[model samples]
Target: MRVISFINMKGGVGKTTLSTNVAHCLAVHEKKKVLLIDIDPQFNATQCFFSGDDYVKYMEDGSDTVLDLFDGDVTRVSTVRGASHKSKKCYEEIKPYKIMDNLYILPGNLNLFKIEISAGSGKENRLKKYLDVVQQLLGFDYVIIDTPPTPSIWMTSALVASNYYVIPVKPDPLSYTGVSLLQTIIDQKKEDLDLQLKFLGIILTMVEESTLVYKRCVETIKSTDNLKDYLFGNFIHKRTEIPKQQLSQSFILDLEKSELSYNLVAIIKEMIKRIERYEEHK
Candidate 1:
């Protein structure tokens, strides 16, 4: 299975949108089993798949979430050391919520942010270990992890468990500045952890084609030596329909035929091809 994380050092860059839509496209169009893990403490991805009432109920019921795995790991270690016999089993099989026939989501919770602080040493690898168990017990063709905008323990865990990372950038100067920050983290992690993660590509999102600033921003990004090759050929344009569909909790594929949906489909197809090519070379 291939694991990919959608991340950025800046917020409001549409990382969640890309992650959710890409997973939806792969599952609905390619007929692949896709698991989307929401690592963002804001629970944006989780909200995407459920309504306000449903989400409240899901949270109130204490559904299995990313926090479960992290907290479970700590308990498992304490139990092994004979610290607590009442420690809960860490490797319980977590059944993801089936959003579609082949699409599932391991929802995220706000408590994850707090859990990170109380986590034990070597907790950065907790996500990777949990995914190892998940892959063994319940297989999937692809795993898409959506990370928070800031650099945090949650983001680190996602990066450690990812095979590739995709950065979504807005057509603006501040967002462009975040690219360097992200690259530095990736470079350091690759050496320190000996991770085999690859850069899937930087996708320009929320673009307004008619604006001069948009054109200038695109030019600057494409001309930058470090970012040129990593920039995606196609960009996702800013569309009113996107927010409408999102507020209604509708999948990109299920939306009516439109420019945004068409571009999303194209981007996903390109992503699949890129992954395939990477696998071939590997």
Candidate 2:
């Protein structure tokens, strides 16, 4: 399976936006069996996929979430002893919520915020192991992981589980400034975990088309060799319509086409092309 994480250490750059739309388009338009995993403690991806009322009910009903892969009855013995986790009968099979014919969602939980991450907890690979088993049993074509914005354990877990990482950045300098730091962290994680992660480029979000400052920021990003290497050509324009679409908990692609939807479709198309190229070279 092609597992990708929509991630950025900086928040408010539209990771959830890219993650949800790309997953939805892949399933609805591209006819791929897609699994959208919400690993963020905020569960914003979960919020986007389902309505507010349904999400509240689901939380109250105590349904299993991505947290189940790490906590619940799962054990850390595999991490301690260097053994295979599949041999242990620690976890039960988790049923993801069906979004449509070819799409499913493994929801996130607010409770994840409460779970303490210690150095010796050894629960980091829980997500990777879960994805491995699901790939064989469920046969997913793509797994889109929406990660939290931080240097926390959840971020590490997402990196560990992903085959590639797609960063979403805003036009602001603060967001651009963090790109180098984020790259350093990713590089370090690749070396530390011995992971074969490929870069899928950066998606610019909340951009002002006519703003000179925004234009200059884009140029500066393109000038940076590290940033330019993986920067996507298409970008999302700042749209008030997106908030309206999101309030109803609707996937942007499912609704009528707007500027937001148009930009996102272009980005998703580029993403597929880039992934195919990377796989061919590999």
Candidate 3:
């Protein structure tokens, strides 16, 4: 399975919008089995997917959220002996909310903010190990994670578990500032865990095609040697209806003929091509 994280250090850069739609397209259009995990403590993606009151009831009903994965009493096991082991944390059946035929979601929770983690607790690998077991048993084709817009354990866990990570940047100057800091963090993760995580590419989002600022941002990214090679060729334009649609638990792709829907479809195609290219080169 291809595990990917949609990340950026700056908020309001369309990170959740891009990730939810991409996963929707992959599952609904491309007919791939997808698992969307919301690891953000803020639970922005969870709010987008479900109504606030409904999710409160979901938690009240004793349904598991992403918090259980992190704070649950699942002891760590040293090895995986052919998918059957004493690692109850990794093997226990996790019931993520099923959104559609091919899409399942592990919702984020507000309670995630209360958990305290310490160093050398092997907490970072909890997600990675659990994902390996679940993917093997469920036969998923893609695992897309929506992470918080900060450098935290959740972000680190997502990076540790991902094969590739796509950074989303808005057409703003401040958006570029955190790009380097994120890279520095990823580099540190690589050195510490020897992770093989790859940069899928940078996606330009919340774009204003008619604005000079938007055009200049594109030009600047293309001109910069480091950012140019990693920038996606297609961009997701800023749409007024996106927030409204998400508020109603509707995906852009659900609009069928909307231009915003096709915009996501095109980007999904590019994402697949980029992943294929990496596989060929690696």
Candidate 4:
């Protein structure tokens, strides 16, 4: 299974949206069995597709919440709550039914935030340990993680678990600094864990074509030696309709036909192709 994480230290960079859309495209369009793990405590990805209100009630017996996993509960490793007998019951109760298939989500909750602090108190690599459980229980074709914006133990845990990392950078100067800081952290983790955490690619999101500032930001990202090699060749342009579509529970391919939607889909297709090529060569 290929484990990929979409992360950025800066918020509002469209990381969750990119992760959801890309994963959805890979599953619905490309026919890949994709598993999306919502590592972020905010549970935006979980709420996006499933019910935000009745998450606790939906969890199965012996299932682990985000908090339980961080606390080192190995028994609940196989206790995932999406698309199973337990989850479907909850889904039926909540209106706005989902059209989901072949895509499994490990729902997140606010309880995870408390666990992050508790786990950070110890020296053990909690995230890596949890990933071993995930690997053993559910061997997936791809595990895409949506992480929180701030640098936390939870974020590091996800990094340690991931093989490929994608950073979504907003078209801003400070956002580049955030990427730099995140890279440094990853490098340190690589040495500590003795793992090759490959940089999949840096995706530029919320791009404004007409703005000179946006163009300058793109040029700056391209000019940077460290990022140039790993940065994605495509950018997702800023568009209001994309968010509107997401709010309406629409897929990327189902969005109103526009240049921006076409460009975003093309970019995601290229990314999947690149990932496949990498796996083939490996």
Q: lDDT winner among the candidates? A: 3
Question: Model 1 Cα displacement at 98 (Å)?
Answer: 1.2
Residue lDDT tens for model 4, 133-170:
66566555677789888776767778877888899988
What does candidate 3's lDDT look like per residue over 1-282, in tens digits? 999999998899999999988888899999999999999998988887789788867765657677778776543222322222122233466677888899989899776787887655788788888788887778899999999988888888998899999999998888865687778888897788789998988898888899988877878778877678898888788888888988998888888898888878889999999999999997
lDDT of 4: 0.69
Per-residue lDDT tens digits for candidate 2, residues 90-120, read 3346777888899999999876887887643
* lDDT of predicted model 1: 0.82
Model 2 regions lying over 4 Å from their true place: 73-92
- Which candidate would rank higher by TM-score, 1 or 4? 1
Error of 3 at 223 (Å): 2.3
Candidate numbers, best lDDT first, in rank order: 3, 2, 1, 4
Best by TM-score: 3
lDDT of each: 0.82, 0.83, 0.84, 0.69
The CA lDDT at 101 in model 3 is: 98
23-139: candidate 1 lDDT, tens digit per residue:
988898889999999989998998889898887677555467777766643421222244432233475566678887989999987767666453237878878987888888778
Candidate 1: C-alpha RMSD after superposition:
4.9
